[model samples]
Target: MADQDPPKKPSSGLRPIERLNSEERLSRLTPATATATHHEYCSKFARDFLDAHFYYCSSKFVVARGGKVKALDEAFREAESWFSKALDWIAATEKIEIPLFYESREVQVSHSFAGRLLRLLMQYDRIFAETLYSLNCGSITADSRETTTVIAAKRIKSIQQLCIPDTDKFAPDGTLLNSSRSQTHGHA
Candidate 1:
């Protein structure tokens, strides 16, 4: 056989490090934008974590330790790790450097930031549970709707396929055929 060209490697759109080091990525964000990005990343982590919880609950497990509550706890901890990474990214990459002149103002700012972080952590459990429940409900509704549509389509097809009796030779009352003999005798 003629030597075939070596199989081409599939191209991934961009290498992670290249994307990170690119000019667009290196461009500085306003503090507000940076804060929003941080929250967005953490929110994605929260959603993925909730999805994992649902998966675990649905999966067939060999061990007794794989109960829903246990699975939920495991998923929560994994998501928290991702959230921690986001926090670290904010600290290391998105610094909002400002010289503090007034001690009281600085104290207030610090307290507010801390409070925000704590509030987010507190909300995680409720948010995760709500997301899982909503997704489950949506899937169930979609499945039921699909089943109903298929059943209705089948019923309609069956009805259409039924053979109706031909009625061209029948009388209006449907008890007897139209008599050619009556017409012939009356005329004769």
Candidate 2:
């Protein structure tokens, strides 16, 4: 044959042999390895708990401060969405019926996640309940009201600091709150 172009190699590049071997091993994972993987995944899911708690506290602050609850409501909903994702992952791990189980990382992570979630939910529940009781009672003294306002403001500031790395940008001004309250009551 006259000088013809050499037969072209396939366009797809070859995968490294080591990578292929590793993937094969991963696919054929033993129970212990699988559990370890699950544990790692669950551990990562803990961030969702923090995010959800942050938003829930934000919602409470919004309500406490007489701000429009809609925005914070949406934020809380988003937190719930993250919590649902975590729950879904936990549920999947529960379905994995492994007998003769060693104390795998997955089992440890699962217990940790469960405990964290429970405590967070319970704490928020109590906070919300107390807030509602305070609101409905509507008989708090002026000093008590001022103290509550200050605490709510502090909580908002704390949550903002948690969620935003640059706290300065999101910082709340206690002076502004005080000025507004004074003006509203014709104190100054």
Candidate 3:
């Protein structure tokens, strides 16, 4: 029998959600980037994260999660463009030991960097939801944003159960620059 190169396997079987997550994690690893020079790579995380949320929001909910909505699709596309531009204003390795999900994947789940990251993700979800909701007339109907709204709450709740204790005083400083509140407030 001919040896047909033993059916190749995927190098990585990361899910869409996981990919989105990985991008966000990668984005955070950098301390500062002189505004990232404004690029698609910069918006990668925001685009991916919100895209996943959009998929979750679709009432067409299918296969793995849900289908995409036209209005939201455009909205998100434009949103990413705006986000990329925003990156112009402000702004990882695989095997060499970079904390992808769980801070070296060795820490306890409750203490992992992931919980802190998820907290930031939850914050993003909220801002996006609120922004979209307001722009669309205070209407978060079941057909558009129901699942995302519902699922994220549940997901956050589950993750928070492990996070609550440590989360009390452990904030990630998502910008990675570790900007102090005064620095952020100074601009405002």
- lDDT by residue for model 3 over 1-188, one digit each (tens)? 59667887788886455532233443344324212211121223334543443222211111111111222233334444543442232211011122222111111111123333333443444434443443355334444344444443444333323322222232343112333587777865
| Candidate 2 per-residue C-alpha lDDT over 112-165 given as tens digits, one digit per residue, 9 for 90 to 100 | 222333333433333333433443455334454345434433433333333322
Scored by lDDT, model 3 comes in at 0.32
lDDT of 1 by residue, 1-188 (tens): 47888888779775545432222331232222221112221333334422332112212111113232243234345445554553343233322233322111111111222233323433442333333333344532444334433443333222112212223433343333434787867864
- Residue 93's lDDT in candidate 2: 31
Say which prediction, candidate 1 or candidate 3, comes out ahead on lDDT: 3
Clashes of each: 0, 0, 0
* lDDT (Cα, 0-100) at 12 in candidate 1: 70
Better of 1 and 2 by lDDT: 2
Say which candidate scores most in lDDT.
2
Q: What's the best-to-worst order under lDDT? A: 2, 3, 1
Better by lDDT, candidate 3 or 2: 2
Candidate 2 C-alpha error for residue 117, in Å: 11
lDDT to native, each model = 0.31, 0.34, 0.32
Stretch of 10 with least lDDT, candidate 3:
58-67
